[model samples]
Structure formats: structure tokens, C-alpha cells
Target: MDTTLEELYTQYPDTVKKNRKKHIVIKSEADVACPQIEANTRTIPGIISQRGCAYAGCKGVVVAPIKDMITITHGPVGCGYYSWGTRRNKARADSTTPKDKIYSQLCFTTDMQEPDIVFGGDKKLARMIDEIVAAFHPRGINICSTCPIGLIGDDIGAVAKAATERHGIQVLAYACEGYKGVSQSAGHHIANNTIMQNVIGKGNERKPGKHVINVLGEYNIGGDGWEQERILKDCGYTVNCVMTGDASYEDIKNLHLADLNLVQCHRSINYIAEMMETKYGTPWLKVNFVGVEATNESLRQMAKCFSDPELEKQTEEVIARETARIEPALEQFRKICRGKKAFAFVGGSRSHHYQHLLKDLGMEVVVAGYEFAHRDDYEGRQVIPTIKSDADSKNIPELHLKADEKLYREGNEYLNLSKEQFEALKKEVPLNYYEGMYPDMKNGDIMIDDCNHYELEELIKKLRPDLIFTGVRDKYIAEKMGIPAKQMHSYDYAGPYAGYNGAINFANDVAHTLTTPAWKMIVPPWERIEEPDTGKQEGAN
Candidate 1:
């Protein structure tokens, strides 16, 4: 099919078509890097954008997930409350939860009222930090400023410095205003640079054992961290702290101790991985546990990195065992889900990650896109050098890093290879690499970026896909259209949809969604009493 913008949106008004055409690209080859789709730009005004702000990207997604750090949203109460716990980054705080972690469960905010916003919110923020210390005595407090703080220029950095002195604890202030950039992507870069500068390498502690790796970007959503840890630990890889998810301030401080970093979400946390390489020489491997094939290949690559005979054997053994365990059900689900068309539009990297899982189930993703990913995310890292820094991107600060004297790894110590072998293996492994989401998608498959409500609705009506893989916001819209939509972001509050067993959960759930009988009632009786019945010649009464 010669899929073109005009053909796809023939009925759309010319103004809307002109704006959106560049954002959408029909794939011409499967998984081949294509740079046609425009990405990482500002959304058109008047569109109902699904993109979260920089504040949500930084405070909500990255910084706030630390199990022992108190993240205070330094603006309105609503911003604090709404972003709180919405991610379902389910963390554990035992009955003996420490004082530092107590405030982790609670959402703290300055509640920057009119008076505070007018005069300055800095005083209120400082006061809030004082109150937090007096009550919780937390080890660390991350102040995430909202839009008001940026507009008013309240000097949160000074407040943080003063608070750090007063409380004798770690107080980090982030200028992650909600309106900072094109999308939440700006916040991700902000958070990554901030942590790399202030937090990581601060501790003297070391995580012992061979194959010690930190899993960056795997936020413990629905116990994803637990499941990943389970597999990795079982495989003899000592799982260190994630970038933020379920990690404590103490745990994160020791991040420099890890030999290797395994990155899951490319858009969100890849910045940290890159900076870590620059500063500490800790090589990162791009790994995806969301799909069976991806997990297998990722594990194989990881094993190759550490050329241990036993570890390699162990990785293969685990793969065979796990694949056997899930193959029976996966096969059955594949039979049911075969040839089902899907459209995935979700936050950042999952739009790419979940496509593998869908493919595992024999589903063809007709369309896929990201809410806050850059051009590189869709076109591959080869495009990074070419991507022009727009005004919005330029507004966010980039860090300059150098190797730390004590913590930096001198060579490829993480990879068990001889100097010659290591150099040769670079061609094979290419550590700290991500191929983006393009290569996996076939020609004629549409790739969109920063997708909106109108585009989604129009595409769904036009394509009539079997599955809509999206977040909570648009799930119901698909259901209303009598199509099954899977909540890929939170997995509908039930997932370990990451590795071996999680793949089974995804397959079963997806199969159930498609095969479920309840869908017959989608066009309820109240809405439509009878079908058109074009075949019966209308039984003229």
C-alpha cells in the first residue's frame, strides 16, 4: 500500500492536515531506521495534548520514586496531589518503615497560594522544608518546582542550600517547571543531570559480587522491579539500585559502585546512562524485558558482556527453562491473537518496548508513537547528532562531566574481555547503545510522535484496529468505540508484564480482552436497539 498523508487524512481540514502530516510517517521497511517523522517539537495550540509536563517528568516519574526521599512539589496543592501515586510505581515500606521513608508515602507541597506566589514562594518553600525536617526528619528532600515558581523566579536553589545547612540533610531543588519545555522529556533531562551532579557517587558504600549491574529506568511499577530483580539475581547478576524507582537516597548514592548499567526505558533515563559513561566509565547495555524475544536477546547480549562460562551457561539455562514454562500458554494466546491489528500510543519508550510483546503474540502493530520521546527515539541514535536543538530543548541545561578520581572505571573492567577481544567485541556488543523504535516496525506501519486525542480518534475510526495499546486517559475512548484497549503504562494496575512470567500475564490478558464475550454489549441496547442488517434488504414494513 502506498500510504501517504493525503490518503490517511483525506477528510481532515487542510490546516490540521498540514500541521500533523509531518508528525505521522508510514513505515516503508520493517525495523529499518527512518527519519521522516517529526518529533520533540511543541504541540499545536488548541489540541488536547496527552503529554505530561517537565515537572511530572522530573519529580513524579524520576525523583519522587525514591523510597526514602521526600519529594515536595513546590507549587499548588493540586499539582502535588494529582501527580502523586498516579504512576503506580508500587514501592514497599515495611511495618518498621524509617522516618525518612514515612514522608516518601506522603505528598508534601508548599501549596503556593496567591500570597506566596505574589511576594515569593521561596520563603514558604523554606518554611515547608523546615516543617518537613521537624516532623519527618527525612534524609533527603527534593523540591520540584511547578510553573508558578519559574514565572515568579523564587530562587529555590538558595532555599535548598539554606535548608540543607539548617537541617543537616540533603536538600536538592529542581527548577522543573510544568511549562518548561515541549513536554515531559525536558524534565527527564533535568532530573538526570541533577542526579548525576549531586546524588550518584556521593556514598562510599559498594555492592559486592560479580556481574553487579544497576537497572536504570525500570520504575517498580506493579512490582516490575521485584520481578526483574528476581530473574537477574537468579541469573547471578547482583541487581543494584535503579535510577529512582524503589531506590532509597542511600542506595542511589552508591550508584557509582555498579560495574554495569542496564537501561530499559531509553527516553526517560538514557541521559543518566550517557552521563555515567562520561563521568565514571560505567558501560550500559540497553535491555528490554517486556517481550520474550527481547528478554532472550537482551540476556544473551548481557551474558556476552561478561564472558563467564558459568554465567553464559546459566543465562541460556534460564532462558530455556522460562521459555518452556510460558511457551504453552503463549502459543495458545498467539493462536487467538494472530493477525490482530494494534495501535500503541503511550508515554516515552513503552510505545516501542511493548511492540515486541505484541509481536510475540502474533499481533501486528499498525501504528505506534511516543508522547515525549525525541527524534532519536523513533529514528535511532544515529539521528541524535543531527537533531537540531530547538528553543524548548535549549532551555533545559546540559551538564559537563569528567571522570571521578576514585570512582571511575579505568577500562572495560565490566566486560570480561581481553584488550584485543574487548576492542573487537565493540562491533558485536556496542555498549550504551539503543536502536530506537523504528527498526522493528514494518513499512506501511505508521509512526507518530507527540500524538493527540483528535489524531487518535481519527486513526481508530479509519483503521478499526483490534487493540489500542495506550494509557488510562484514552483507554475508555477505545472501549467506547467497541475496541479493546490495553493500558500499557500501568497495565491496568496489574503487571509484572516485564519478563518471563510477565509475558504470560500479558498474553493471557490480551487474549482474554480480545476473546471476551462482554464486548458484545459494547453497543448497548439503550444506544442502538438493532443492527442495520444490510444483508436482509431491510424487511420493508
Candidate 2:
């Protein structure tokens, strides 16, 4: 009795229906490969999409998390105000190199108004940078331009240069206008470029360690980064820096000196990772710490990268210890959560990463989608070259990068692997490859791109999933329809959901949400009556 996807599409106009059909696909057992969904395209005008703007991607996600920098929004107050402390990128001042340099607690803005917009806000941005330098005396300052500044053609880069010279502090600017791309992905790219140009590779101080590594693409959401750091430290690896989460200015500068780079959330930070490899000859590895198995695998991969017998032995021991500690709780939750159905519509990597945890809970992901993921995210990295650039994508600049002759390593000697050894290493560890969401999903599953509310409502009506995983925007809507919804974005403002303990916490949380007694009372007993069916045309007969 459920409406089919075809029937749902009939409601839209011809062009709209045709375009939307490509984005909504059903997996079939007969298919040799996963169905391709059109991604990184503009959202339909009337659809309520969960996608955030490019500025949100850049300033909010990438730049603001650095605890030591004064990130000033170089436009209207609303842009800066809304993004301030929203992501919950937790930082510990006591843990930083210079304990006094923490500034993630404060929100700085140019607060551009009508007058500023009419005649450019560059002067205001420059003055704000000077004030920040004088008052905070922070290690650095990052200025991000909102939509109006881009429209008015304000030169933020010029202002940054002058401010840097005047204050004798590092100043960087990002032209991450809100409308640059289809979503926040563009802003992420811009932020990465700016950071690479200004912040990275400036420090001379070096930390002493044999297996030093940089944790890239982690924003420390709800202490997720902290948990990851704890596990890595336990394995006897020196975590030189986390890309941005709870990161200090000094930690960022010395990233070039790292032996390796471990990338967690690849979509937002892959640009910097790739650039770092090219510039610094620092080899990178893709890592996922979202699930227990994923964390175990990621740790093993890191150990393999080092190819040290002692490190590998320690990693295995740590894995065994952590697994023993959390197995009982995991088993209990799995028993309670078996056969539950789940639907996920979240950000780029989460739609895939959280699948590992859901499977650990014995839940099946019936439907999944990304708000702003491109082909590389949904499909694998192999499709990166095949993907044609559109106007929106083309608007974002790709910086011309050349190797730093002094810093770049000449050969694969850093990897400590010969040609034959490297070939054998792939069998033990996956390097420079990402088999995306498709390979993980099963037949009869659904995959969507840039999923909107209408599609979600329709899918909910048809699938009647037991749990929904998405952002806060759609959480209440799913709950209103009598389903338990867990937020993957902010982790419902509670987590350390990135290791062995985190996996147990996630499984327990899902079990608790699904087994709660409150859902039984959604409709009272009085409303459960079935209406009597009147015999058709009995009087006429």
C-alpha cells in the first residue's frame, strides 16, 4: 500500500521530476554496481535542504576551531554570531603549547552594516584586525568574508597584508562567500587553501619522536578528537597535531615536520592533506575512528605505515585491551537493538562512517544520503578526474602549488617501503585509496544526494524506519512521526564517539532510544479503534 518513488516523482513538473529522479536511486540485486546519483548540484529552489552555505564550510567548520587564532568574520554580524560556538569544537587551554593563547571562546566580527556595505568593509576589517592584535595579542588572526563583502568586491587579502605588516602577526583572509558553491564544500576548499598559504610550515621548533603523525580532518566534535588522540597516544605514536580541533597556532605551523598524516573526515580536509603531501612529501593515510572495528583497522593501518614491530605489537595489545573492556556492553546493546531499521541523511563522510556503528548495533541502514557530498564522496576517488566542473565549482579557485625544494622528500624513503615492499604493504594496509559508500551498502538499499524534506517524509512513510540519523534541523520532524532520531552532526551534544568506548556508547544510545517506553504512548488506546466498513450500495441492491 506504500507509494512508489515513481509515483512520488509524478507530483513534480516534468523538468523537476527528471532532474530529481537522478538523485533518488534504488539499489537492485541484479545491478553489478551501485546506481549513480547526481551530486554537488544546486538544490531545487523550493526544497528544504539541510545544506549549509560555503561560508559555513570555511569559517565555521575549518577556521573557527583553531583555539589560538582570533577568527574575525569580515562582514555582517549575523554570519559571525550564528557560527560562534555552534560546532562545539572543544578546546583545553591548559593542554595548549602556550596556555595563554586560547581564543576559541571569543567571537570577533567586523559587524558590517548598510554604510559599510555601500562603501566596502575592507577598512573596518583592517581596523578590527589591529584592535584584535592590540587587545588579544594572539598568535594569529583569520579574516573570513561573508556574502556582502564578496558582492561589493572588498579586497580582504589586501587588508590582511597591511594588517600583518602593521601588527607583526600572521594575518590571513578567506573569500568564502556564502553563495560560491552548491554547499559548504566550497568554503572548505577556500579555507584549506588560505591555511596552507599562511599558517602551515612557519614554525622552526620541532618535537622529538620517531613515529610522529598529524591527525587531519578531525574537528574534535563533542570530544571525538580527544578520544582519537588518547587511543593514538596509547599506541605510542606521537600525535604532532590535530588539523584544527582544539589545535593551537604553533601545532598548525609545525605540521610539515610530521612523518605521516592521518585523515579522518576526508571531504573537508582532503585538499590540505593532498597539498601537504605535494609540498612537504608527508605521506597520508585515510582513517575512520567512528566504529570499534574502524578504529581497530585504522590503528592497525597506522602501525603498518610505520612498519615497526614494536609499534605493531603495542597497537595489537591496545586493541585487545580496549576490545575486552567494551565487548560486554556492545553485546548487550546488540541484543537489544537487533533487526532495527535505520535511515541516515547527514554530511559527507558521516552518512558512511556512522554505518559502521549502526551495523555494530545489529541495525540495517535502509536509506542513506549526503547533504553536500560530491561524486568522490558517494562514488570513489577514481571518479575525481571524470567529474566535470560546473560554474559553481569553477568559481572556487584552485591554487597553483609547487613543491618546497627544501622540505620535500626526494623518494618513498620516508614511507620506509621499497617498490616490492610497498606492493606487499597494500595487502596489509589500504593506502591512497578510498572505496566509497556504494561498496558498503547492500542490495535493495536507497541512496540519495542532497536529500530534501519532501523525499525524507515520503521515504519515512514508505519505510517506517525504527531510527533516523541526521542533523538537528530534521531531528524533531522524524520524532514527530513517531521514530527515534539521533543526530550525527553534533552527536546530540554528547559524545567521545570515535573509539572503542565511543562505539559502545553509540550502540547503547541507539538501544536506549529505540527501547524507550515513551513511543508506546504516542497514540492513546481511545484512538486505536478501527472504523466499521459499511456495505457498499446495500440499500440500492
Compare the candidates by TM-score and give the number of the best one.
2
Q: Which 10-residue window of candidate 1 scores lowest in summed lDDT?
A: 94-103
Per-residue lDDT for 265-310 in model 1, tens only?
8889988898989888888888898899989998888888887889
Deviating ranges (above 4 Å) for candidate 1? 1-4, 7-15, 30-33, 93-102, 524-541
Q: What value of lDDT does candidate 1 attain over all alpha carbons?
A: 0.84
* Cα lDDT of model 2 by residue, 198-306, tens digit: 8799987666877888899899989989999899999998888887998888889988888888888888998988898778777788899998888898898889887
Q: What's the count of clashing pairs in each model shown? A: 6, 0
Once fitted onto the true fold, the runs of candidate 2 whose alpha carbons sit more than 4 angstroms away are 1-3, 94-96, 523-541
Report the number of backbone clashes for model 2: 0
Residue 464, candidate 1: how far off, in angstroms? 1.2
TM-score of each: 0.93, 0.94
